[model samples]
Target: MRRVRTTHLVLALRGLGRRRVRDAALSVLAPVVACCAALAGLTAWAGAGRAGSPTRVRVTEGRVLLPSVGVPETAAFFRIANEGGSADTLVRITARDVPGDVTLSQHRMERGDMAYRSEIDSVSVAAGERLAMSPVGVDLTVPVPSKAWRSGDLVPFTLEFRRSGPVRVLAVVVRPGTVSPQ
Candidate 1:
């Protein structure tokens, strides 16, 4: 009877030991499994365009207006079109030939016919919409180069967007008072 009791005690202790080992292993593996799951989910989300509608932006009718006699800065205009399902913001503009930082500026009319121009940080382009930049509206204020810009000269510009990334476009140089082609 004593031997039988001892054998039962040993068996119970072995079972408890096995349970402890299994619990410890599960505790260690749980976090690893969770991390793997999270990584997979993130990868899938990125593959699907970062969990939202992709932004597709196209630039057209790009023109750079040369500075006139007394004007120190020139302006660049473009017809920006967003054809995707997401909205995007034009954050920055860069030119290879221009020396200084290109800035985004807007022209607004006040109470009367008085026009006001201000430097803007960014401009938003709604999804499936077109933003046509003109001299009297939103335009990029670019620093004028010392060398003169002739009409029909092509200037390379890179426009950075918040979501759509950088877009390279060549703008045709036009005279200050001349109308650019559409």
Candidate 2:
């Protein structure tokens, strides 16, 4: 009876040893395979030819000119930089915080008359260059209430990029004759 018991114990020990070896091998192999798969996926994502695959944008500066009744429109400026290998565009501009409509406008000299025209299409930003859009002696304009904002006030504005989408920026309110360095 004692010999039978010892033989059964030895068989159980061998089974346990085999299981530990199998588990160790699987633990190492599984992570290695998973890592290889992850690397392959990342490589493929970067290889796709897309404009602004890795683009960056920020509000360089913002200012607002005082508005008067019937001239409730103000102008704001932005500086966009595209670090990607491809070019991008300013798709749209919106003021989610302000209580008015915002659109892209440019000053045009039409038939010897200086006028502002709305730009509905996206404004392109060339690769490796900075695009500056401003209001003074320029085209970009923002319409707002005449007495809505004061100097040194911060208004939330969003700049929509063609490839980078929308980025929110705080625009500082200034007097009508304020100018920021380029």
Candidate 3:
């Protein structure tokens, strides 16, 4: 009677499909596998068209101007140097610590009225040129107030390039009306 009961228990347990264990394991592991595959693809694709290293694009003298007494918005300046054999386009700029979007803007004279316009889509850097970002020319617009920005404050900035990927920069905050060098 003991041997017969053991055999019946074994048969009942075997009734559960053996493939159920494999299915459950696959369901748990599929998303992780897919994420790894997607990351690998992006890593390969980012290097497809770039001929030079990402370090060729450098940012120097990066600063965000402190907002004046009445102005709430501020401007940023940077000297972007492309020391590579291939030209690259600065496609995007992002700042996580700020409250507003970092927009690429340039002053335009429309109908004799000089205005700061957010019309620049992207800025291009030649093979061996240093693009000076200034308030008179193309600059980054941000909502950095005097309260938020102080002298010697460092803010994080990420500049995305068409060929070089993204380069991280630390922008220093300067005093109000600090004139950027020409």
Question: In terms of lDDT, which candidate is strongest?
Answer: 1
Q: Which runs in model 2 stand beyond 4 Å of their true positions?
A: 1-53, 111-113, 136-139, 180-182
Which of the numbered candidates is closest to the native, going by highest TM-score? 1
lDDT of 1 by residue, 48-71 (tens): 665567889999888899778756
lDDT of each structure?
Answer: 0.89, 0.71, 0.81
Deviation of model 3 at 121, angstroms: 1.4
Q: What are the root-mean-square deviations of the candidates from the true structure over C-alphas?
A: 8.3, 13.5, 13.5
Query: Of the pair 1 and 3, which is ahead by TM-score?
Result: 1
- Candidate 1 RMSD to the correct structure: 8.3
Error (Å) of candidate 2 at residue 109 is 1.9
lDDT tens string, model 2, 1-182?
Answer: 99999999999999999999999999999899999999888777568644336666655776666565577566787667776767777877788655666777665556766655656566777666776766533435677754467688887778888778888888787786566534
Residue pairs in candidate 1 whose N, alpha carbon or C atoms collide under 3 angstroms: none
TM-score of 1: 0.68
Give each model a TM-score. Answer: 0.68, 0.61, 0.64
Ranking by lDDT: 1, 3, 2
Model 2 poorest 10 in a row by lDDT = 133-142
